[model samples]
Target: MNRWFAATTAAALTGLSVIASPAAAAQNCGGPDEPAAIRFAFAQLPFEPLTGAKWDPTPVASNYDPCATLSTILVTVEGATGSSPVQALMFHHGEFVGTGTAKAHGFTSLDADASSDDTVVLTYKTPDESTVRYRWHDDRVVMLDPAPSAE
Candidate 1:
């Protein structure tokens, strides 16, 4: 009687496993936003490419100023020893906004040496017009519209 009971329990467990298999699982990963894609004009360097970079756009409350809100972005990339031309990250927000590169300013250019651990700084006028600048800081890439100057 014990042997028969054990066999019956095993069969029931096997049936449950089959019902809970991945083949019967749902497809969606669990979120509204799709995974972002990263593309570079040049080849990717060592380490890992910037994957979990985040951006936050400030909410526009009342006045209809052209540039009301601001956006903050941040990401980290690997370093390269020798000089190699490199560019990365194509940002798409509602429209194909633009691409940001690690430019060492007056030094060589975006296509000169890879700027590792450099935070790409961008100032957006209205999420449309913007400037992409790179720096050697591992902080947030704060994008803000220039404040009005005193008359």
Candidate 2:
């Protein structure tokens, strides 16, 4: 009787509840359901993509905006020195846009030197706008105004 009771108790104690899943974690960093208009602006620092594959791939910023007048850009990278994410507010012709932040994890150049000029790249897509891609250089966020392509 004692052995049977002990086994039952052990089995009950071993039972585990369901916790967060991979799909839930991916939602925070731009999941597939998220809108494409979401934009992310980063500093002039190279960063690796969040791809699960193990290879040198084109690092992409899933959340990026083109028409939105970025006022600030924040960056955060682990295992790197002299390269810090920035929080900048930009004004073009006197207007306001949304805010964003960036982080470079497991990146090669980002891990080596994230502060170098003309290294970081921002990529995003929009419904009305073509795929917007920009590279930071000369201490400036290359602003790309969306224009309708005559097809």
Candidate 3:
């Protein structure tokens, strides 16, 4: 009976460890308003490309989910000349992965469709209007659609 008790206790402890592990804790993407998540997203922005740009104090939109393996924060930053460019900051497990649009250009507006947990559809209101889908694959944010040409 003592041996059985020991085995049961060990099994239970092992299960608890797995539950408390970071991998398990990261299962939920957490809320969009999570302070830590917001800070992480802002810290990852490519400042070189966004020099002299001003963005809202708050994020326009955000999505998080570990099942999808990708998370995102959308921010609209206006340049000194009044050109508003919407930037998609990508993340994986709360770490900044990359930007959805590589070029530094202005778009009239931007929207994100995160209907699926694993991928996000970003639409940009440019002269022609364009859409791009992004996902986390092979440790990076991969654009499923053709990237927009730099203006």
Candidate 4:
């Protein structure tokens, strides 16, 4: 009886941890459903018929706090080849808003992070790096600082 009770207790504790892990992780970032956010970003891509395009496994930036009034996430949609232009997608409150104005071309890398609860800073590397800032206003994401044209 003692052996059975100990095993049951251990099993219960393990189950509780498994259940708590996801909640703990969600609180840190990406809200309760990260996959949902990824799917939303993919569907809102400007280029249709995605073809060989795929979303990068990890988000370039995300500040998805459930308790915050606003949250943002940046994801990259990569093309089949390194030289292909990559799209930087933006999401607000888990809803697909739009893509960053900064253009990433020819294997250029892009990264972004939330500087504040309502502001996001994007860094684009086209051999020379440039930064752009966007803010969440009203119900839209607005570019605060425009990036230089890749002319």
Candidate 5:
């Protein structure tokens, strides 16, 4: 078989489901059968694809948006400082798009919804069984409501 973006064509794009735990931050990609795990290593984020013969990320949740022009991958990573459990990451066309983060407990899952104006609406789920709504732009994630109001 042949593919240009074969490497990027990995897993599903379902929302995340996080449970708060004292255990170290980790990303469960590829299964025990496979042996490749991508660690943040440092606080600095990665913008490229991690392809290793040793491991294949049988990711728990993923969301690939065709509407999103940039070919991006969404993953959760822990901070290098070890302060936060996990943070949502977006890599587009092998370039770092942006990231979304929450409290120390960390975010478990995420889903993106594109708006008519181009802004993306991301719904983040926390371990506490709470939801955070945000308006995502090209470079930042702003906490805002998507509902229309005023009479």
Candidate 6:
């Protein structure tokens, strides 16, 4: 084997192994809004606060865990600008935790299941629009539905 070829192949294989390995645990994992993170655990996200005119908050998840001290609440806030649009925020124990992808649309109706520990599934109904389900993990609320076609 050529000397340079063997060295290059060994280096390439070593790099591939590193890429395939799991990332090291974070000391403090931030929420989904932590910005451009490739990996984050669910427990890192707590509820976030939301404030706006014409906004309404309902504790859909709390219904299932009514007796618990901490509950998940969903808030629908009217957008302040075109770029901002409407915002769907989730809170726990009155503290801001996270936001949903329901931006630009008001989520007037909400339902959630709090049975599973460390996870909550929230569904929202928009007036005359497609409904969306957001999976609430420790760090973020992810939209389960496929986005509407731009066409």
Best by lDDT: 3
lDDT of each candidate versus the true structure: 0.29, 0.30, 0.62, 0.58, 0.33, 0.39
Model 2 lDDT tens row, 33-151:
21212122222223434532222212222222222222223233443343323222222211213222232222111111222222223322223433322334344556343422322
Flag clash pairs in model 3. Answer: none
lDDT of 5 by residue, 1-151 (tens): 4464553343211122232221211223211111121232113543222221121123324443323333223343322222223334443322334554422223344444443222333443432344445444566556456322211
lDDT of 4: 0.58
Where is model 4 poorest over a 10-residue stretch in terms of lDDT?
104-113
> Which residue runs does candidate 1 get wrong by more than 4 Å?
1-36, 39-81, 94-97, 101-151
Worst 10 residues of 5 by lDDT: 29-38
Clashing pairs in 1: none
lDDT of 2: 0.30
Task: Please give the lDDT score at residue 12 for candidate 5.
Answer: 18
For each candidate in turn, the TM-score is 0.19, 0.20, 0.61, 0.58, 0.34, 0.34
Which has the greatest TM-score? 3
**lDDT of each residue in 1-151, candidate 1, tens digit only:** 9999999999999989876654332122221121221222112323333432222122111111111121112223333322222233322221112334333111112221222223334332323444445432233232233421211
lDDT for residue 113 in candidate 5, whole number 0-100: 46
Residue 142 CA displacement from its true place in model 4, Å: 1.3
lDDT of 5 at 92: 31
Clash count for candidate 4 is 0
Off by over 4 Å in 6: 1-71, 76-86, 92-95, 102-104, 113-129, 147-151
Question: Which window of 10 residues has the lowest lDDT sum in candidate 6?
Answer: 33-42
Question: What is the model-wide C-alpha lDDT for candidate 5?
Answer: 0.33
Q: How much does each candidate deviate from the true structure in C-alpha RMSD?
A: 16.3, 16.6, 6.8, 5.3, 15.7, 16.0
Per model, state how many residue pairs clash: 0, 15, 0, 0, 11, 9
